[model samples]
Target: MGKLPAADWTRREGLRQLTAALGAENLRWVGGAVRDTLLALPVKDIDGATPLLPDAVMERCRQAGIRIVPTGLEHGTLTAVLPEGPVEITSLRRDVATDGRRATVAFATKWQEDASRRDFTINALYAHPETLEISDYFGGLEDLDARRVRFIGDPHERIREDHLRILRYYRFQSRFGADLDEAAEEACAALAHTLKGLSRERIAMELLNLLGLPDPSATIARMRERGVLQVILPEAQACHVEALKRLIAAESTSGIAPNAIRRLAALLPPAPEVADSVAARLRLSRTQRGQLNCAASRVAQDAQNPRALAYTEGMDGAIDRLLLQGAELSALDGWQVPEFPLRGGTIVGRGVIAGPQVAAIMRAVERCWVAEGFPGPDRIEALLEEQLVQVLRDPSA
Candidate 1:
């Protein structure tokens, strides 16, 4: 792991002084900040651990004139909004009970006490707030350097403590570009069936985070291979796995654009009901829900059309759908759809009544104009007046 930069050292010193004011020992940085500092990845939120209780931390912050928010007071977490960003300061705590969803934890006075409750060994590393010294109670430094994702203790026990950890393991591994530890993978596989007990929202959040990875298709395929995908997203059980692999690999190799919706669309099964159900279960945003609907509809509509590329799916939507189609079929390069030159107002002004007939005339003119390669607005307007005159003269025609 690289040494903490000078600026990080400054922040660490500030936190240490805050801890000193609270009379708390062992106040240190923990979790992602430490892991990312080692990997040289950008660290956004810095999480700290301290023997001080949440109230005590708040008292210290108040003394320092720092803004404090009781973000997770019940969970022993306090947030101090610094100029750069909010720092999350959590009191050392160990889980007393868990139902795979929420945990009951008690504040502890020892750093190891808190470290023991963490999900993975790598996440258990801590850096002293003042000295910028790393303290690894669980061989976290070694596991991190080895690029191995391993649970702190018995995988089953850790998983049972929180089933979400099963999904988190894969998500973290994908993000860090680390290989899965064999024992951890086996343990995850063994408890894969228990994933059904987790809430759909929890599963959805993890999947979204997983998709946000640089190359999530392969990790997703691995999840499918382990049956974890089946348990969480049965709609995708029969997804074209090999096709997805090739699509992602090609995108990486051929410099093709990468997008999630396209990849998801490619993996969608043939069953509409299953697709809709999955979307609903995941509680997708209205826009995402609409995009999925459009992707599915377009895939079916353009199934046999060579000119499918000409169809109007929104640009973002098209990219998503095409990626999902995999590399086997090429997506038609998108082109802007022609706008209608005449409106109902224009048609009514041509002595046509302001009724359904006006709308009908506008539609007819627009369709013909688009079909005729969308000539200039002047030509389209002249053609529309002529067509309207002919239509009014011959009702039957």
Candidate 2:
């Protein structure tokens, strides 16, 4: 019986346009939008559920001159791009069959059947587009008020339908639940093996989403205890929990925002090969894999100056290493890595000779420049001369 978002929801000019196009009564706000609104949380995605078929909804929008994309027509979803935002309106559906990765769904004639198909109770609440009345078919409102995350029907059955829900269960539990739903946890734990069937991309995305949460240490530890983490990411063993916890605390103390990739690195064993292997298995992007490799290696922390490490790697990579090492980060404040004023051509022009010797001399001078705390061009010029003399005196030395 909870009231949905009224003022803010009304302000969405896009939703208003969709209301005019789709009829106020035909579409209702559903899923995370309603749940977050009831909890006084910010709603980024405003989706709706309707009993109308996909073609019918598409025709209505076309007649109303609204832009609609059949984002997933086969699954009964159409996206209406409004001035306020893109609202997804999907026909109410019931699961016909599921294979733990995806579901074969059929349009449902009743909201009850659609609500029954949702994974969790908190996500099943629907709000009238005009009246803003909440409809909870499965005690969703009560569970939401109690700060609980529970599966709609049977936990095992729900996990069996989509194995990715196993990770989502922990994520929502951390974000909204006061205590773990015992039945849901046991079901997820028992079906943890099924998670292997999910696409690597989906698993990586879910794990990153969980790591993206502020201080998901306890939930991650719970996942570890339930054997879920080992099933998905065995690289992160029991001992790495404390490592991740330390990194989270260090990030807070250092005034750096939580970063999912760096946090993922914290749970690793500080080996580039391991990070490379894991990143490949998870199908992370090349840049993300490179960053993970850099963080897993101890080369960055071996430098005495943070700026030195920043110069060698990058600001992001240096910060990752500092947070992982739990070291003071004040030295990097208001700091910009200075451009190496002396280019290779500049080195060659300075009588170092154009060859591998020039490159080696350039490297030596660059090291000296960095060691000298990234001095200005004048110092670089002097260092260039100093290295030239040294290299000239001992071409072998």
Candidate 3:
């Protein structure tokens, strides 16, 4: 709501040195810092736009004895690691060519030209790092204050420049603003099919960010409504409006936010192969993949019986998985089940073989213990020994 206070003298000096070394003028702060200053959010990354070429910027940084990295030189980006933090410096550029996955850009001298190529107006604002004077070329400051996210030009054409904007729209909507614009929504729906052309890694990253939002189910439902989710995660397509509404209601009642794996697991229907394929396609990390698999497995097995929960998912595992499911079902008031008390060593000590027989006996003992209200170690050991003796009496019994 208020203009950002003037840049600190120290930062100004650094910028001045950078500009003097490069023989350039009008180096301005841009992107997230400018957007957040208006929103009063804590800014993390400081980005600047300048008319100097990438090579010239690097040369200037080097002359000043500053650490510089050509992170994306071809795309006109340079990273200068100042003592305060890393500042990203990018030359003004227009898209020379694009295939949605990558772009060829040519340097430009006008800030508006650079802003026009950006995805949204709210992000196109800039500020003089030294004086902290704000610049709104496309009414970005007004849009930022209004909390609206509008594409700089034609939505469909912008999306064609990079299909990732489709996901970025939802992310920004969830993070910074409220109320989706009908025209933006309609454009997203019409261009939904183009999302399939995006790289799997890019899609996965966007989906992960979306799911990490505080109230992701609504955004996900919007994606589904627009047929975008169908392209990236068709397995979850069956979870339409009603299912999402129920999930959101349940989440509101539970008062606990579900993590990405739990959220993704809840979105899936009762289909093993579909879950497996989705996990594989998304290239989920091993831990995420395992959690999703466990959640889906618990959901499929109808893990209602205490004995089954103890034997299959164990105590801690059962509690975690059940809590996630409870959040999805809005059944947080259910009674808590005790964990399994028996260990494999308890069965092995009873002269049970160390192979599948030991595992089988331990599982059975644990099941019994869970069903019997999780008896103490003494009782569990006695019950386990009794089962082991009976099993030893007949190998095939």
Candidate 4:
């Protein structure tokens, strides 16, 4: 990590345009972009640190015929909107103060001061735009090489500055570390109660992002043992960890990608009401809540017939059930569950005296069709005819 990876990311037109706007000597790549570059991972986000003030940044970008937004002018951050994507360039800043949720900051010209204000050492690495020289402020290079995700100064102080960092620490560790930082883990556990002050959205975001990582089975088990998981999700128990691990193994075996909310459901007791309560507490989106409910209430029919399950519970829910149950998912790959071939109008056209009876007949036929392995539309018509005759013969039945 002496220099940034020998990649074309630096040669990107947007970055070149940005470098030309802010003198190459004045701009340095910062944050995750710099960190991931050192690790040779694909850099998706491009952020930079500059000694120039926000007004200067805006004027420079404008004079260069570049589009820049005053995204966080108060914090001296401006986003250079480029063709590749928006790159955030922030004036060197030192935190004025923080109260675990928000921070007040003032601009400064020192890079070390800005790096000191960041959460973790690995994230504070900086890279020169032209020379690709990494400015190691907090031994980030060493930490990066060691696969460590340690807090910058004091882990406790960092967590106190933003209680969300407690979760963030674990999230970063899960993503980047090979082993746990015991002292940092203890700090997070000690101050886990402070997480209550943070917004549910923030908690949900971090928790889900952690759960959605490549495979967070070990990290999750660590969180559970450290008491951090219980602080955030009281519903989770020892068994849920095992369930999540099983789900991970199943996901790998079936070649299905991981879904964060689905993993959250695995942590929860398999009950719809419990899932509902957790979703409500976390202020999850309607789609997320629905998935949680569907997962909690597992379908009795096994994944042996995935189409029927997919038909009733939807593709997302069906895949969730299959993964949780550790069932084969080859049937779901590139398989778009088709709509029920029968329709209410089709039943009504058969002279069955349309009403609730039409819907009833349609559902009965649909169930038979599903039971018979989601046969073709032609088969559904025959099933519909037989059901219509049987219902018409015995209206009470």
TM-score of 2: 0.96
TM-score, cand. 1: 0.87
- RMSD after Cα superposition, model 1: 3.4
Q: For candidate 4, write residues 1-397 as lDDT tens digits.
A: 4788757778888888889998998799988988887777888888999999988888889999999998988888889999988999999999889999999988888888889999999999888888898898889888888998899989999999999999888889988998667889889989989988989999999999999999998988988887888888999999999999999888888777889998998999888999999999899999999989999998556667887788888888898988888777777778888777676777767887778888888878878988898788789878887887798789865
Give the clash total for candidate 2. Answer: 0
Candidate 1 per-residue lDDT over residues 84-201, each given as its tens digit: 6678889999999998888999999998999999999989988766566788888988888888888998988999999999899998878764666888888888889888888887
TM-score of 3: 0.83
Error of 4 at 110 (Å): 0.6
Q: How far is 163's C-alpha from truth in model 1 (Å)?
A: 0.4
Better of 1 and 4 by lDDT: 4
Give per-model CA RMSD. 3.4, 1.5, 4.1, 1.8
Stretches off by above 4 angstroms in model 4 are 330-336, 377-379, 395-397
Error of 1 at 245 (Å): 2.4
- Ranking, lDDT, top scorer first: 2, 4, 1, 3
For 220-307, candidate 3 gives per-residue lDDT tens digits of 8778878888888887765433454565556566565646666676677645566677889988888777777776675634445534
Judging by TM-score against the true structure, name the best candidate: 2
